[model samples]
Each structure stands twice: as structure tokens, then as C-alpha cells.
Target: MTEQQDIQLTFEEIVCACDNNIDWVVSVIEEEIISVHGKPQQASYSGFQLSRIRRAHRISRDFEASVPATALILQLLDELETLRKGG
Candidate 1:
């Protein structure tokens, strides 16, 4: 099987991708909904993480969900996907 490389995005790029402010990204990081590499101010995220960020932002915006709630929702979704993959 061929291997695929995950794209990494900087803090600023992540914020731009979500079209939100830095505070939002920081809050997600603080909540541990997503993780990063490198220094705090210079953190970088994988493309997979970027998908999580976008999902969390949409869930929060569309349902007015709290960060913690969004985190739980994302976890459940992750589990479901894993099951679908028979893992």
C-alpha cells in the first residue's frame, strides 16, 4: 500500500482555515479537543487535526454547543468511524 503524508498547518493557517480568531483555536487547544506540535505560539497541526477543528467549530456554531459538548460529540463520532472500519 502506498503511504500518504499528512499536511501540517501552522497556528495562523489553522485560524484562517476556520475563518475564526486565535482565541477560538486557543480554547480548543486548552480543552484538549485537538493537540499541536512545536512551541505554544508556534504550534503546528496535522491535516487530520484540522478536520477536527472544522467539525468542532461547525458543531458549536450550528447547535450553539459548548466546547465540552462538542468534544464529546467528536469523540463519539470518532468511535463510530473506528467501528465502521472494523477496528
Candidate 2:
């Protein structure tokens, strides 16, 4: 993958990119619904992670799913995409 596609972003950047609030992001982090790659005090995430954050936030908000439930749904979606790609 290109560096652009794999670019890393700080938590705040992810929030703006995903249009999600910091509290929600922190909540997901605490729930382990997604992850970051830095110290706990300054966690950073990849561009792809921003995509997942967007999807998870939207899914949870629109469908009233809990963080764990949303994570499960996203996992299933990822599996579906992987299967479609024969990966």
C-alpha cells in the first residue's frame, strides 16, 4: 500500500477526519472497539483506522448499537470484504 494510504494520524486528526468527537473516540478506545499505535496518553491511528472509526461511529449512532456490537458488525463486514477479494 502507498504511504499516503497508510499515513498515521493523531487522535484529534482521526476525530476531525471521521467527524467524531473526542469523547466517543476515547470511549471506543476504552472498549477496545478500535486501537491506536502510540502511548496511551497520545494514541495515533492509521488512515485505514480512521475509516473503521467512521464506520463504527456511524453504525453505532444510526443503529443504536453498543461499541462491542458495532465492533462485531465491522468484523463481519471486514470478513465479507476479504472473502470477496479472495484474501
Candidate 3:
């Protein structure tokens, strides 16, 4: 498979493992604004998108920023992934 295809497949796997409410997942992706190559970008996430969202939530919480519950959901999703990975 091509590299892009591999990435897409991997991302889908992550989303499935996320186990979050699908509607909330979609909202988080829609609301999140990210920078790619110094340009602002938006993402359309599948279930795997939760991994990145969760990471962002952790960083924000560590900095003591009050992220909303939807954001916190990502944090929980990440923790679940870590446990599943046995790391």
C-alpha cells in the first residue's frame, strides 16, 4: 500500500480504539484549529482522530487551562489507548 494509504489506515484504527461518542468526536474535530506548515488547518476526523485530540487536552490541562468536557473526553481516550498498548 502507498504511504498515504497506510497513514489513513492507521488513523482509522486509532479512532476505532478511541471508544468515544461519535457526535462528540466530530464536534471536537470541527472546533479544533491546528497549524500545519505554519498555515491554519482544520481536520475531518475518523475515530482515530481522538488520539491527537486527547494529547492536546492533556497539554492544555497540564498548563491549567480549563478545557471543556468534550476536550477532556479526548484525555480519557488517550489514557485508554495507553493502557491498551501496555505502556
Candidate 4:
């Protein structure tokens, strides 16, 4: 029970925050780039997922990369974070 623990961003929120289309975000979801909570009829994202999505979105936009390429970059970044933690 802490900050960002239960902060669920709905599809509308995500679209607004990311300034992207619902269909595009839905494509990300369909690709399993990140998972969300809430009913099937009404999904919501967490801060962690939002951060990850932002990273991928940034990389995609900055480098004009494809979805799979963005995913690869995100995976590498996560690995870099893990290594930074001395784990």
C-alpha cells in the first residue's frame, strides 16, 4: 500500500497522457508489451507499465523504430536497470 501502487490509468487516461491513439495503444496491449488490471470491459494501467510504455514510445518516436525494435530497446533498458542495481 504505497504511492503509485493502485494508480490505475484507464485507456482514456493513457491515450491522453501519451497523446496517442486508442488503437495504437490497443495494438501495444495486443502485442503484450505490458499488462493492465480492471475488467475486460474496462482496463487500466499502472505507473510501472506507464513508465515502460513511455520508454518504448519515446524510443519508437525518436528513432522512427518499429514496434519490435522498440520492444528490443525496452528489454535492453530493463536489463541495464537490473544490472545497475547490482543484482
Candidate 5:
């Protein structure tokens, strides 16, 4: 497999590792917890978004934030891609 293919496989692996629901994913994006540029920044994601989503889920689970878990999960996924692309 090529380097690009390996990266793609890694991304898929990360996505599969995420166990949160869609609702949680949305919250991550809405809360703006993770960003491509940095924190407190609104942006979109494109690559390695799955990894970010997983991280967001872990944070919410660990902190027990007031926001809905599902929403946060979605947001994390969305922002993750944007952050990964650095756009």
C-alpha cells in the first residue's frame, strides 16, 4: 500500500475506534472545543476528523460536561476534520 493509502487506513481505524453517538458528535462542533487553528475558533474539518471526534468523546466522558453527549460527539467529528486540514 502507498503512503496515502496507509494514512487513509489510519483514519478509518480512528473512526472505528470512536464509540460515541451522533448527538455527541454535534455538541463537539457547537461547543467549539477543538479547532483547526486553535481553541475558541470556528471552522470546518476535513482530515483526521474521526480522531478529533474520538478525543472529544473522551473529554466529555471524563469531564461529564452539561451538554448532551450526542451533540458533543457530532461537533467533535465535524471540527476534527476542519482542524486536521488546518483550514
Candidate 6:
């Protein structure tokens, strides 16, 4: 059987996947919405981190949410998801 490897994405790929710019990505990073594995230019993220970015991006774009607001929203959503999962 083949083992599955986690996909690691670069900073640019995350920005592209979220259809956002570097500044916006930086904003989310500053707000601690997601964590990176290296320096900004060479930053790397897991697929799960990318999901968080997408969710934050959507909230920011759709709700005109401030970085802090987006962070809080993500936290609440994560907690809700955990509860739903009976975790």
C-alpha cells in the first residue's frame, strides 16, 4: 500500500489558492490566523493551513472583516466545528 504524504504549499501558492495578495496574506499571518514554516519569502503551509486561509479570506472579503475580527470568527468557527464533531 502506498502511504499518503501531506502536501506542503509555498507562500505564493497559498496566495494564489486564496485569490488574494501578499499584503492580505501578511495581514492574516500577523493576526495569527495561520502559521508558516519558514521566512515569508520561503514560507510553507500544510493543506490544513491553506483551508484556514481560505476561510479567513472568504470572511474578510464577504464581510469586510478586520484582521482581528477575521481571527475571532475563525476561532469561533473552529470551536463550533469541534463541537459538531463531538470533540
Best by TM-score: 6
Candidate 2, residues 9-65: lDDT per residue as tens digits? 776787775464777777777776676565534876776677778888889889999
Question: Higher lDDT: candidate 5 or 6?
Answer: 6
Encode model 4's per-residue lDDT on 1-87: one tens digit a residue. 766445777777777655756766766666667765644228767887787777767887899887777777877887999999998
Error of 6 at 9 (Å): 1.4
The alpha-carbon RMSD values of the candidates against the true structure, listed in the order shown, are: 1.9, 2.9, 9.4, 2.7, 10.5, 1.6
Q: Rate the local accuracy (lDDT) of all candidates.
A: 0.84, 0.76, 0.46, 0.72, 0.52, 0.86
Write the residue-wise lDDT of candidate 1 on 1-87 in tens digits: 999988978788889876757887788888889976655469768888888899999998898888888888888998999999999
Off by over 4 Å in 1: 1-3
TM-scores for all predictions: 0.81, 0.72, 0.32, 0.77, 0.38, 0.85
Q: Between the candidate structures 1 and 4, which one is better when assessed by TM-score?
A: 1
List candidate 4 stretches off by more than 4 Å.
1-5, 37-41
- Total colliding residue pairs, candidate 2: 0
**Which residue pairs clash in candidate 3?**
14-48, 15-47, 15-48
Give one digit per residue, the lDDT tens place, for model 6 in 26-85. Answer: 888888899765576587788888888998999998999988999999899989999999
Backbone clashes in each candidate structure, one number apiece?
A: 0, 0, 3, 0, 27, 0
Q: Which ranges of candidate 6 are over 4 A from the true structure?
A: none
lDDT: which is higher, 2 or 5? 2
The reply for model 3, stretches above 4 Å from the true place, is 1-6, 10-14, 33-51, 56-87
lDDT of 6 at 33: 97
lDDT of 5 by residue, 1-76 (tens): 6566313323234335546254554455456553444321233444566565666666667777555564556666
- C-alpha lDDT (0 to 100) for residue 17 of candidate 6: 75
Error of 6 at 45 (Å): 1.6
- In model 1, how many backbone clashes occur? 0
Q: Looking at model 1, which ten-residue stretch has the lowest summed lDDT? A: 35-44
